[model samples]
Target chain A: MRYEEYNLEDLFLLAKKGDGTAFEHIVRQTEKQIYNLSLSIVKSNEDAEDLTQETYLRLWRSLPDYKGESAKSYIFRIARNLSIDLIRKRNRTPGSDTVILTADGEFERDIVDHDPDIRPDEAFIRRLTIETVRECISALPPPMRELIVMRDIDGLAYHEIASILEIPEGSVKSRLFRARERLRALIIEKNIL
Target chain B: MSKHSCKKYDFMIDDYIDGLLSDDDVRKLEAHLSTCEDCRQSLRFSIALRNMTRSAALEFPVGLHERIIESVNEDKKAKNVGSKRKIFRLGAISAACMLLCLCCTAVFLMLPGNRKSESKLPPDCPMSEAATDPSAMLPSFNGSVNAPEKGEDEGYTYPVIEEPALSSPEYDENSPEDAAPTPDETCAEPEEVAPNDKNDYEYSSTDAPANPAPDVMTNNSNISDRLENAADAEKSETHPVASPEGVPSARPGGEEITLALLIVSGLLAVASFIAFLISLSSIRTHSSNKENKK
Candidate 1:
């Protein structure tokens, strides 16, 4: 039989005992969500990677002092802080070449290279669509960006999103719906459907 | 567009998809969705869109776990490193504040700016009566005055500069009867002060100790040199009188302004750092407090 899954309590105990493997397991599990969250905020993979790394580093460093905040809440708070810092730094030094996506999920600049004989396969198109969706999500203002991405894509509960962002649940749902409609309209405008 | 959509069902559609509505609300939404084509289609699209987005959500970059775990392990190895770095950062700010204070003090002490003008001579003022006598005053390259060696006064030159005519009418108005005596009249013979010019004699004698003899002619100095020296002495004495006024001007000048700004900023930084340390310690204590035993 396969081994039982380690819950956060078990992981917490193991991590506190200096179990690198247990901590690594936790890192592997949460890394995707934190990385994606950071990517949405910073809009750059390199910066997102740096932010994710920083968030984990802080988590491990502060783990001993952590009394009993939930894993998700702790991770998200740390990641959010790092992402916001990256966003602020990006704002100050603008004009660097930033990643841009079109409706087809292809680079807007790279679209100039016409390949008449080669057509992107379905998986490739799917990947591009996802990337384009993320790019479109990134283009929205930060307030709506995090809300829509976290609720729809990250599959966070509305209440969880509210708690993570420190907003009221009503604010989360209303804003998510409003942003969802706007995002859908944006995708439609670009003929991404 | 949803503002114009069905109120009872469309509003519930989003919550229903998230499984947030109660059973009664879900039942109402389901009943409405069966009949309302618009909301049905909207809910379907919303579900599909969410699925697509969820699939497309960012993946962990390769080696992210290894890197993060590596960093965490490194932090564990240097167990004191985190606290050490934090202390270092606090120390850095304190050191910067200290450096700023030092720099400000250096500027105040070292730079030649806005000094007490009473102690400095006017730019046009000669060092002394001997300034004209190269023999009486040896030239100094470093600008410090070297006192004359013995017998240096033997070749002293007495350059007599003409006194500037009194330009203000106050003098003439105040002394109407003491029309200046002609050069020949002044040198021809020693003359007693006419009673009308007695007040002028008293004023001049009070200011001129070298010529304090009651009769202006009785003190043996040449009339022109006496006049020039007296005028120079008056100009020199007025300087010290004006410097208290200069001190008021000095207080508002740029040197004091920079010092004030530096002092304020340094103090603010030091105070803020102290507050940070206090709060950080309190937080550490609060967080590290384990549950109280029964």
Candidate 2:
């Protein structure tokens, strides 16, 4: 049977039994989200990629002991923890706190322009390009930035984010609301709206 | 250019943008929004921000999937090698322990005390034969020799005779009949004597005079001297031989050392066996996991 057809839990169980194909499928399924989460936290594509790889490596090693929970939450939790560890280690080093704007230029170039055929008012809502949003996200505190990335960018449920971050769902909702408001203020400061 | 003035409903804007608002709350917020343009602008900015953030999804870097798989395979190979090494190490330890145990057993068997205790003497051996015929160890005489006879109330009683001084004139070293036999001659048939028997007497006809001289038999001093000499010879033979430096023949603390070695080797053998078993089980588990993967 093709491993791609298996659900996340089935893939995890097969991977725990040392099924390489199932593990690869699981990796292929989650790498994009994990990379995005890492990028949102670390603000560097290179570091984010490294963090993503390390996350999966750790997941593979720990699969034997995985208690068959939500695979997406488990994988995201690993990615989140690895990203936090990288951030902490970077904090310990001198002159490493500076945010690299490498991805901002790429984001500006890659983002599509607002379509002129649409209504002017609707186009105004699409005026905040991907680069401006990323810059605003990069400017926020780490906690708020994480909430925006997990909730808005990744579209994870409040309960799933709570499970990943090991916090209460109510805390997730409140914090997420504050994060969105904070992002809105940043967008206004950029005069993108 | 509009400043947001409706601060009370600002919190509900997020819930509204996220579509989490109830129909009643939506109606209330919509009524408030129709009269207020600032809150309307705030709601529009929140919607724009959420949309832009969702548009910011990152593409997974190319070649990362292959790298991750390679690293995992490397880790699995390293773990398999490590388990094999563990099994080999445990097996080596078990073999070494068994060898040590065998060596300890050999050494234990070679110990003087163990040898004597564990071995059985032949029935025809003098030591075995003397158990049934204790009189065979006594000197033989044609005439009635004054043998110590066992009494009902008491043990054996010998004739009370005073020992003569060696410097006395009657005691003669030159007279063949009066001369005491050498210890070697008395101890020649050591098999006939029990090591623990206190009354061991040497009785070899070849070492004794063919006929006892009349003067030697008549002399009470000579008889007492001969009996004393026999008793001294028995005592020397029964006791362990001493070294020329006066040290005892058996090693000091040899038995204790051997016993300690045996106990230690036994414990080591048991520990190594347990280690071997654990490693074997782990290897089996690892192999079974590999099989399942295949």
Candidate 3:
């Protein structure tokens, strides 16, 4: 039987009960998003992997106590918490940050030159758009950075993000809106469109 | 040429893109989008941004799942092995503790002749109950000084009155080998950690009362006189009269060592209990998982 067919709640229920296969299934399904979220926050490949391992390890240990809930939100909550902790370890400013991108600095370093007139195919445009959003999102403070990842990237519901972060639903809505607007302005300013 | 400004329905833009708008709200947004180029562009931007994010494949590195599962298994194995070996480990630790405690007590109890092992902390104030607990060295300020973390020179210290290194006869403040701390550095409430006295600054509490040396006494003669008087007064009034045979303020070296050993023992016992508690927690977690699996 394909692991994807199992309900997340059922998988979580089994995994918590020491079902190794269910735990494997849970990791397979959720590891991508958790790794990506960690990558977005810490901006390091190795650290992201470390964060992914930590997040899953904690989930494995903690699943026994988790009562019933959306596993996606629960997993992301653990991932987000670990990522935020990693950020704090580096001694950066807290909550939301405003990363002002300069041409020579961290935000723009990896961006390759692209001619606006040379039109690319739909596939290329989608790829380019995804990369541009990543560039823009990486420049945001951690709060907004992770908000966009949860709302737009992971497609989590507002209430899920709220429950995951333990913030008010209204706060999630506002932060997400602000994050998107900030991303839009960065896109326009950088001419990534 | 709509009746309302683009700004009027601007807030609804997020709702429109999110599909959170009611049909009436959608109608209003659509009407507003038709007239306002800015609003229309914004809507397109939101659509594109959302689509890109939604389409962004969460590309974790290859074999991440295997790594996670392996790590969890290893941790479980480690815990199981740890618990299984706990009794042996506990007995070994207890044996070592007993052996060490006995050896130390014997050495201290045997060394009644080595009583003159005086403290190097400047013969400023004669000893008090502070001998057993060094932070009580001076009463005005007390903080339990934990060892500084790696690369740190001083741990958390409550701002207590600091004796200037210059005031102490042995160390020359101006000497390149041991420069005295600046008055400001010593006086700064939060920032200054007296690096010179860091080892001796085991002040666990500041409740004991002692005269803060007058900061204004810059002349050596006056400073020396004041220090002597302070010492004399402290001895006559505060110190218990030492019976003729002993160095009298309770066994300084032996007492501190024994107290330290006791603290360490208490910490170890507490740590073992915590480990025992963690083992119990894991067992509960294991049982809960079993119940859930069934």
Candidate 4:
């Protein structure tokens, strides 16, 4: 069954009874989405794991107060807040081996058009493309990284992305389109497409 | 016109995919998409990309679900444990305080009536424990020399007697002051006169008295020896120039007991002060950490 079909109250009702099995089911069901959301912010497995745990723990504690209808959104809200907090905390610690993505207005744009289908050893090329795409995403500035992740990976609507990121919907569309165009250019330049 | 006018609908394509448009807006978007090739191609790629992303979302580490559940359980257990510990600590502190209060009450009950008055010595101190010849004075229940013995020097005069065994010459050689007759001398004598009357006698330094001063005579020779020993106690008086400063000096056994008690009390005070400082620092540090956590 789709996780979204199961309302939060059902999970919360079972969880409040000190039911570990219910908690496990909840965690297993939400773990992928939560992990992906965390990874998009922290960009590290360990940090994502930590944020996911924090998100789950918060959800567990807040289950008693949950009104049930908006449970999925509630969990997402928790995950979002936790991810942001983890990022802020990471920035505050001194001597931390932080990887900061510095944004620059002097963006070098490349426009390229490649054939939609150029099957060049599907397995190897797909692996290399995936790795290179990850590297390119890592290289992007904070704004661009977030824009690309929201639009491409999470597949959020421009309005939803804008709301999540606290930017104008117009800004979200433009940035996402630009980010995609840039990724396409990099793929062509790196000869991965 | 349909092909050329559809460019405006491209911008709303993302909103339409997200299901945010009204029914009328959806009908308009569908009417535009039915003829716009470029818009349709863009929507197809966007949909494919969205599908790929949904399909490619990474799974978490195998045991993370179980681990999260374990952590939640552990956190609750730890909270319960912490609350129990807090209650236990409060109980322990209350028990300790009660015990301490009981002990202080017991100590107060055991103390003599005049404890506060005895704590402060005279501002102008004339004597220390080292200078006082304790063996000469009578026993006192408390350490203070200002307080009189339980009985006032009941009507009596103790006489001074010379000792033949330890001649004055040999005694003077051993002690710079004139020799006091040994305990055996005055222990045998008796006196019935009051102590105040004997205080009026001009103590004669000479050995002979033709009048045979009966007022100066006491049957207890040991008591006379005690008086003569106290005669050398002029310098050790805590307050000099008093009419009867010779009273309340320590006897041999009383001096030993008071000295031991003073030493033990001093050590206890020092240890308690050190422990109090350590506990204060620990509490301060703990409170600071709590503030930082907040």
Please give each candidate's TM-score. Answer: 0.48, 0.64, 0.50, 0.44
CAPRI-wise, candidate 2 is acceptable
Off by over 4 Å in 2: A1-6, A92-123, B1-8, B16-41, B116-252, B288-293
Question: Candidate 4: which docking quality band?
Answer: incorrect
- The list of candidate 4 runs beyond 4 A from truth reads A1-6, A9-22, A57-193, B1-7, B97-294
Taking chain B only, the TM-score of every model is: 0.30, 0.53, 0.30, 0.33
lDDT of 2: 0.67
Q: Could you give candidate 3's per-residue lDDT for residues A112-150 as a string of tens digits?
A: 323322323344334446777677777766667878887
Winner on DockQ between 1 and 3 is 1
**Residue range B151-208, candidate 3, lDDT tens digits:** 3424343333334443243445235444332333332211123433434433334622
lDDT of each: 0.59, 0.67, 0.64, 0.55
For model 3, give the RMSD to the true fold. 29.9
The alpha-carbon deviation from the true structure for residue B218 of candidate 3, after best TM-score superposition, in angstroms, is 99
RMSD of 1: 19.2
Tens digit of per-residue lDDT, candidate 4, span B103-143: 55555445543133331223333222212443433221111
Q: Which residue pairs in model 1 clash with each other?
A: none
Per-residue C-alpha lDDT of model 4 across residues A65-167, encoded as one tens digit per residue: 7665444456666887787788787763312223343253323443243333332233333444355566656555444555666666765556666556555
> Ten residues in a row with the worst lDDT in model 4 chain A?
A93-102
Evaluated at residue B122, the lDDT of candidate 4 is 34
